[model samples]
Each structure stands twice: as C-alpha cells, then as structure tokens.
Target chain A: MIILHHLNNSRSQRILWMLEELELPYEIKRYERDSKTMLAPPSLRQVHPLGKSPIISDGEVTMAESGAIIEYLGQKYGDGRLIPETGSADYRQYIYWMHYAEGSLMPPLLLRLVFEAIKSKPLPFFIKPVARKIADETTRQFIAPQIKTHFDYVEKFLGEHEWMAGHKLTGADIQMSFPLEASVARGVADSYPNITAYVKRFQERPAYQRALQAGGDYDYA
Target chain B: MIILHHLNNSRSQRILWMLEELELPYEIKRYERDSKTMLAPPSLRQVHPLGKSPIISDGEVTMAESGAIIEYLGQKYGDGRLIPETGSADYRQYIYWMHYAEGSLMPPLLLRLVFEAIKSKPLPFFIKPVARKIADETTRQFIAPQIKTHFDYVEKFLGEHEWMAGHKLTGADIQMSFPLEASVARGVADSYPNITAYVKRFQERPAYQRALQAGGDYDYA
Candidate 1:
C-alpha cells in the first residue's frame, strides 16, 4: 500500500486530490506544521533528509518533492487513469505544467513568504530597508510578472476550459490546485475574478472534498 | 529540423549536450550576455514572453524552461532512447532527477549568486555590514548545503555506480552533467574525489565534446 505523508494547507493536499482522482488505495500520515513559522516540523527530516512535506514512502521507494511525487504517483497508480502516456501531446503539456508549478512558479511564492516574514517581524533597523529592497527586486523579476502574466494565462486557460489540460480530468489540475489556492490564501489574486470563480468551481467538486478529507489536515481556507 | 536560440555559458548548454547525447541535428542562434550587466540577451523575449533560456522551436512547437525542453526532446526526438517509458521504474527516477535538478538544486545556485553579487558590489560603507549579515544568513539557508551535502551525495553515488540509474545512460545523467560541471566551475567540490572523477568522466565524453564544439562559446570551465 502507498503511504502519503500529508500536512494541512500545504502542497500535500494536491497529492491527496490526485490519489482521490485516481481512486488509488493509500494510507495518510498527518503532519501539522508549526503555527508561527509555518514550516513542516523538524521531524520530517527523519523521513527524508530534505525534511519536506507531502512525501511518500512506498515500500522501498521514498520520493519527496511534490512535482516528483505527482509524477511518480501518476506513473505508479494512474497508469491507465490520471496521466496520459508520454507519447501523447497532453503528456508534453502535462510535464510543462508539472514543472512550471514549482520550477517557474514557487520561487516567487517562497520569496513573497520570506518578505512577508521580514515585514511582520520586529527587525533591527539596520537591515530592514536592504531586505525590503531585495524583496522588491525579487518581486520585479519573479513575483509581479508571475501573478500578472502567468496567473492571467491560467485565468484565460480556466476561462475557456474547465481543466488545465484536455477534456479528461487529469492530475495536472490537481497538481496546480493548491498553489492557486495558496495564492488566494496569500491575497495574491484578490482581484482576479475569473480565478476567484474558478476556485469556487474547484471547491464544488465532491472529489475535491474527498481529497481534503483523506488528506486529514488540509483546511482549504 | 530544430532551432535552438542559445546563450553562451548559460543553462542552455545543457540542452546542447542532450542534443549531442541523442545525436540530434540542430542549429544554434547564439546571443552573448551583455558585458555591462551580464544578463541574458534581450533577444530571449522574442522566443518566449518570459525571455528565458533553452527555448527550442521544432517546427511550430516552441517550448521554454530547461527541464521541459529535456523531457520534450526525450519524448519527441529520442522516443524511449534517452528517457525510459512512462510507467517504468527508470521513468520514475528520470522524473525525480528532472525535478531535482531545477526544484532542489538550482535555487541554491541562484541564491548563492545573489549573495556574491551583494558582497562584491560597490556599496556604501554603512550598508556593508548589514549586507554581509543578510548574505551570510541566506547562504546558510540556501547556498552552503548544495556543495557540502548535495554534491557529497552525488560524489558517493557516482563512486558506487557508472550512471545515474541502472547501468545505462539516461536523460537524468544528461540533466545532472551540467550542474556538476557548474559546481566545478563555481569551485564547490574539490574535496570530493569521486565527484571530481565523475565530472572528468562526463566532460571527456564524445557527445560533450560535440556539444562544446556546437556551442561555439564553449565556456564550460
């Protein structure tokens, strides 16, 4: 049996959604991140040296990264189901979105969270302005365009189509679902009406509900 | 026929090496990074809105992002030659390394670059102390581990095995080749005898020679 180590309000929820969509039998081990730091607990490092959430220990194979996890699960569990074979056009696009979610997308999300942390904290006066400036530049290079251009692209994508890819509901949508939700959780997309409506649509699906329930900790705020 | 819009000493060289590994025919439209700022050439935007490296135009399909490009090439040109089939264990490991190269490894590289930039830049005396502190902390979180822990893992693995997976060459090795080379270029791994030897092994390959020749600005120093 596959054992998914899950955490609330983390990318791990996407894994649960994926497992649910595939109807794959799996066990969930819940992990709650600390309230203040919002980091996956240190105990996680024992599971994998990376100490990240949404990891899986399937018999002998222990893979950690979420993008890797989704790709692995899609291959191992959803062979005839969630993911299309590599030869298909959708598979090509699927890999793009799968990598894009983390590679192209998450760096800015991480920088934003770090900037927010610096802002919220009572810091020594000497370094705060420099920190803010670096954060601003990071925003210019990665964050601003990501939300404006990429989010607009996603909104346009969700506008004409119900899913991220083809007519079938594949893991790509589930792969992207949490980050879009986190953008909401972070107030990053407060003004994008299409995305707001799209998130609502995603929330209405029973599979989404089942995914959250199975995940054990995801609150979907 | 494929057209690769490439820049010298950039991540695009990885794409070049993979093309050599597959012996795929291609043309390179080269651009030099601006001497003043050392940024990727402005011509990149013409390839994609994001203005990134390793954008390939195969007929009408234009793709950006390095990992996506490698996977695309593997599926489209090499078929099951460079990467494994989608459901195989080799395929799963291939996907992990694909994500690992960018998701886990590259961020530290860029972060370390950022710190070096902050340190070496001409700045006011008042700001240097705080700047040093920030650089030190960021380096702790993002930079130091890639060389010490990450490359150590790579060093040991290469010592124990002939390739990244099984006994055969795959795209994962191709993906890893650039980073290991880059780490050497960055002076990150002298202490690890095995990684140093592995780097020498990969660098001496005929395909690597072809890639360096095709690249024109062969600065894989």
Candidate 2:
C-alpha cells in the first residue's frame, strides 16, 4: 500500500490524481499550510526533512519530490501504464516535461508570487511606495518576461501535441497538471488558449475528479 | 555528435562534466551571459525557446533542462554505465536527487540571489533603506531559513552515503554537482564539511578536470 503525505492546496494534489489514474490503493495523510504564512506545517518535517508535500512511503521506502515520486509510482505500480516506453522520442519529451515543470517553469512563477507579495505587504506608510516600486520594477524587468517566455513556449507545445509528451496521456501530463492549473486559477493564463484548454481537458478526466474528491478543497482545481 | 549550449558560470558546466565522464565525442557552443544583466545571450533562444542554459542537441533531437538532458545522455551513450539498474532502491534515490537538485534546492538559492541583488541594487537615496529593509526582512523571515533547511537535509544525507545515490557515481551525483559547487563558490556552504568534501571529491576526478579545461573559466570549480 502507498501512503501519500499530502498537503492541502499544494502540488500534492497531483500525486492523488496520479494515484487515481493508476487505480492504486493509497491513503492520504493531509497537512495544512500555516494560515498566516501559507507555508507547510512543521509536522510534515517528520515525514520528510524538508516538510514539503507529495511524499510517498511504500513499506520501508520513503520518497519526496513530485517528479521523483511520480516516476516511482509509474514504475512500481504503473507496470508501464502512465509513462511512455523508454528510449522513444516521446519518452525523451516525457523526461523533459517531468523535469521542466518544477525545474524550468516554476521558479519564475514562484518569483512572481514573492514579488507580488512584497508589493502588497503592509509596511510603514513611508516605505510602501518604495517597496512597491522595487517589486514592480523587478517584475516588469525580469519576472514577468521570464514567465511570458515560458508560457509562450508551453502554449506552442500544447498547440501541437495533445498531451505534454505526445498523443497519449503520460505521467508528464500529470506532473504538469498542477502548474498549468495554478496558472489558470490565478487568472494569469486566460490569454493562452492552449494552456487554458489543456487545463480543462485534464480536469474533465474521471480520474482527476475522483482525486479532487479525495484530496479535498484544492485551490487550483 | 552532442552539441552543448554552454553558458558561463551556469549549470551547463555539469553537462560538460557528464560528457567527459562518458568519454563521448561532443562539441561545445559557448554562449556568454550579458556582462551587465548576467542573462543568457539571445542566440540561445534560437536553440531552446525559453533561452535557458544546458540545452543539448544529438542528431535531430534537441533537449533543454539539465536533469532531463543528463538522463538523456546517460541513456543514449552510457550503455548502463552512469545510472543504477532501474527499479532498485538506489535507482529510486538516484531519481530523487536528479529532481531535487533543481526542483527543491535551486529555487531557494535563486531566491537568495534575487533578494541579495535587491538589497544591493542601486536606488534613489530616499528609497534605498526601505528596499534594503524589505529584502533583508524577507531573507531573514523566509529565504535564509529555507536554504538552511535544504542544506541541512543534504548534509545529513551526504553523511550517510559516499555518493548521492549509493557507493558508485551515478548521473544523480552529476546532476547534483552544480548546485553544491555553486553554494560553495557563493561562500554559503563552507560550514557543511560533508558538502565541502563532496564538492572536492568530485572536482578531483580526471573527467571533472578535463571538463574544467574544456569548459574554460568555470567559477564554481
């Protein structure tokens, strides 16, 4: 049996959906974010030292990091179901998106979030404008363009391939689901039709709906 | 032939090291970062849409993202030399480090860089203190502790294993080499003996030395 250490409203939701898609029997141990800080609770540290979620333990083996866990689950339980065959061209693309999601894509999005928070964070009245200016300038000059570059790249990819890897659904699609969904939920992806539709197409999956029910109150869904 | 789009002082150096380790014939197409902005040159955009470093092309396939490319090179040229056997416990750890290097680790380090720049960035005399304060507070409140948490976790792991995955040098070690080296180069990792020694251990490799010569002027080494 697989035990997923799930954090509400985080990337862990994708793990649940992956489990559902694989039809694997798993139990979800939920952790909530600190309401004020929006950081994962300290209790998660007991599960994995970093305390970030989407960790899974099967028997004696424990794992963290979504891309790794997704690959693990796909290999251990998937029996070659959720991933493309190794050494195929699509397999190459599969590996690319799996790493690209959190590696290449999320950093700028995370930076954008940090700067937006800095822009609005309550400060001494005199310091407010200065802080906003710094945040706005950084966002305009760097963060925003980096994001646009990524989105445009993803949009172009999706325009050609039905899924991230190829014609079939693979773990890369599951791996990519959270970031794409979050972009839509955050209202920044309305203009990218392929991305918006890609999110919708994944959401409409029966397995996705079941995972949503199991995960509970996911913000990005 | 593999052609690496090498970028100065960037993660692409790891790809060069991996190529040398495999003893494969390859070519390097170096792209210098803009001296002022420290961003990859526009020429890179022609290779990968996002214009990121460490992109590689073999035959007709061009791939981006370090972890993905590392996996690709290992699979294509390694003949089972650089990775653990699939589905083993060590292989699981190998995959974990591959993603964790860039996915979990680099973001906080990158954030620290951003905030450090914000603190030192030239600003109006009136606003400098306020911008610095915001940057300082965020570093104190969030980024610093996050980096510490990740480094501490890595330190504990390295204490137990000679290599990142197990006793042998796998692609995971190659994947993790950049961030660990950069942390040392940036002067934040000296306190962690295991990390420092691990960086030294790999740097002493003949393949790594050859990579240094081929790479030309790597800061992290």
Candidate 3:
C-alpha cells in the first residue's frame, strides 16, 4: 500500500491526483501549512527529514520530491500508463516537462511569493515604501520576465499538443499542474489561453475532482 | 552525434561530465554569459525558447532541464551503466537525488546569489544599508536555514554511500554535481565533509577532468 504524506493545497495534491488517475490504493496523512508563515508544519519532518510534502512510502521505501514521486509511481503502479515509452521522442518531451515544472518554472514563481510576503510584512511606516519599491523592482526586473518566458514557452507547447508531453495525458501534465495552477492564481492565466484551457481540462477530469475532494481545499484552482 | 549547448560555469557542465562518463562522442557549442548581467546570452533562445543552459540535441531531439537530460542520456546511452536497473530500490533512490538536485537544492542557492546581487547593486547611499539589511535578513531567516537542512540531508546520505544512489557512481551523482560544487564555492563546504569529499571524489575522476577541459573555466572546483 502507498502512503502519501500530503500537505493541503501543496504539491502533494499532484500526487493525490496521480494516485487517483492510476487507480492505485493509497492512504493520505494530511498536513496543513502554518496559517501565519504559510510553511509546512514541523510534523512533516517525521515522515521525511526534509519536512517537505509530496513524499510517499511504499513498504520499506520512502521518498520525497514531487517529480521523483511522480516518476516512481508512474513506473511502479502505472503499468506503462501516464508516461511515454523509453527511447521515444515523446518520452524525451515527457522528461523535459516533468523536470522543468520544478527545476525552471517554480523558482521565479517562488521568488515572487517570497517577495510579496516580504512586502506585506509589518514594517515601520517610514520604511514601508522603500521595502515595497525594492520588492516591486525585483519582481519587475528579475522575476516577471522569467515567468513570462516560461509561460510563453509552455503556452507554445500546449498550443501544439493536447497534453504536455504529447497527445496523451501523462505524468508530465500531473507534474506541471502545480506551477500552472499557481500561475493562474497569480492572475497571469488570462494572457495565455492555451494554459488556461489546459488547466480547465485537468480540473474537468472526474479523477481530478476525486483527487481534489480527497486532497482538501486548494484555492489555486 | 550528441551536441551539448553549454554555458560557462553553469549547470550545463553537468551534461558535459555525463557525456564524457558515458564515453559518447559529442561536440560543445559554448555560449558565454553577458559580461555585465552575468546571464545566459540571448543566443541560447535560438536553441530553446527557455534560453537556459544544460540543453542538448541528439538528432532531432532538443531538450533542456538537467534532470531530464540526465535521464534521457542515461536511458539512451547508459546501457545500464550510470543508472540502476528499473524497479529497484537503487533506481528509486537515483530518481530522488536527480530531481532533488534541481527541484529542492538549487532554489535556495540561486536565491542566495540573487539576494547577494541585489545587496551589491549600486543604489543611493542612504538606501544601501536598508537593502543590505533586507538581503541579510532573508538569508538569515529563510535561505540559510533551508540550505543548511539540505546540506545536512545530503551529508547524511553521502555518509552512508559512496555515490548518491548506492555503491555506483550513477547519473544521479552527475545530476547532483552542480549544486554540491556551488556549495563548496560559496564556502559552505566546511560544514559538510561528506559532500565535500563526494565532490572531491568526482573531481579526481578522468571523465570529470576531460569534461572540465572541454567545458572551460568553472571556478567551483
């Protein structure tokens, strides 16, 4: 049996969706982010020392990192379902989107979150404008352009293919979901119709709806 | 023929090392970062719209993301060399380290670089101290602690195994090389002897030397 250590509204949701899609039997041990910090609770460290979510344990094997988990689940229980066959062109594309979701796409989005948090932190009235200026400038100069580039690249891919990797809805789409959902939450979705449509299609899945119900509240969608 | 589109002192160097280790015939197309911005040159966008390093083209396959490229090369050329056999404990561990290198490890390190750059930027004299305070505070409160956790985790793993996955030096180690090397360059290596030793072990290898000679001017080692 697979035990998913899930954090509500985090990347863990992607794994839950995958389990549902793959029809794998699994149990979820839910975690909640601290309301103030919006960070995962220390309770998660017991599951894995990294204290991050989207970790799973199957028998003696426990693992962390969403892409790793996605790949492992896809390989083990997927029975060749959500991933393209090895040595195929679609397989190469699948690997790119799966890794790209976390490797390249999430960094700038995460920085934007951190900067926004910094800007909203309680500060002396006098220094508030200066902090705001720095945060806004960093977002404008560094984060926004990179985010645009990534989304544009993703949009172009979605324009050509029904799914991220190719014609099939695979683990790449599941892995890519979080960043794109977060992008929608950040109000950048309107500019990219294909991405918006992609997210919509995922949400419309009965399996996805089941995962959402099981995974708990996710404001991003 | 395999073509590696390398950027100086970037993650792309990891691919060069992999190519050498696999004993594959490959050519390098090196792109220098802009002297002022220290970002990948616009020329890279011509290869892939993401304009990132560590991209490669094998025949018609053009791909980016280090983990993806590592997995692709490992599957296509490895012949069960740099990666473990499928459905094994080692393979699961291999996947974790490969994705964790970029997904979890690189983000904090990259943030540290960005914050340092922001702190050093030419700003009005009066605002400079404020900027430094912000950067230092973010480093102290957020980035530094996370980085320490990651290093601690890596150290624990290396303490157990010679390589990232198991007894073998697999593509997982190759994927992990960049972040560990960057940690050393940033002067954090002293805190984690295992990681330092791991980097040293890889550096001593002939393939690594060959990669360094071909890749050019990586100060991290």
State the lDDT of candidate 1 residue by residue for A1-221, as single tens digits.
88988777777888778777777788988788899867778787788767667888889888877788987887777766767676577776777777777776666666566556645556588678876776566567655765576687677777787766666767777767767887876678788777777777776788788986676655554
| Candidate 1: CAPRI quality band | medium
Q: Write the per-residue lDDT of candidate 2 for residues A1-221, one digit (tens) a residue.
A: 89999999998999999999999899989899999989899999998899999899999999999999999999988887888999999899999999999998899999999999888888888888888889999999989998999999999988988998878789999989878899999998999999999999999999999999998998887
Provide the TM-score for each candidate, comma-separated.
0.89, 0.98, 0.98
Q: lDDT of candidate 3 vs native?
A: 0.90
In model 3, state the lDDT of residue A191. 96
| Predicted structure 1: clash tally | 0
lDDT of 3 at B152: 91
Badly placed stretches (over 4 Å) of model 1 are: A34-38, A137-149, A152-161, A216-221, B141-149, B218-220
lDDT of 3 by residue, A1-221 (tens): 99999998788999999999998899999899999888999999998999999899899989899999999999988887999988888888899888888899999988998899889989888777888899999999999999889889889988988998768899999999999987877687789999999899998999999999998899887
Whole-model lDDT, model 2: 0.91
Q: Model 2, range B1-221, lDDT digits (tens) per residue? A: 88999998888999999999999999999999999988899999999888889999999999999999999999988898889999998899999999999899999999998999987888888888888889999999989999999999999988988998878899999999988999998789989999999999999999999999999988777
TM-score of 3: 0.98
Off by over 4 Å in 3: none
* Number of clashes recorded per candidate: 0, 0, 0
Give lDDT: candidate 3, residue B163: 90
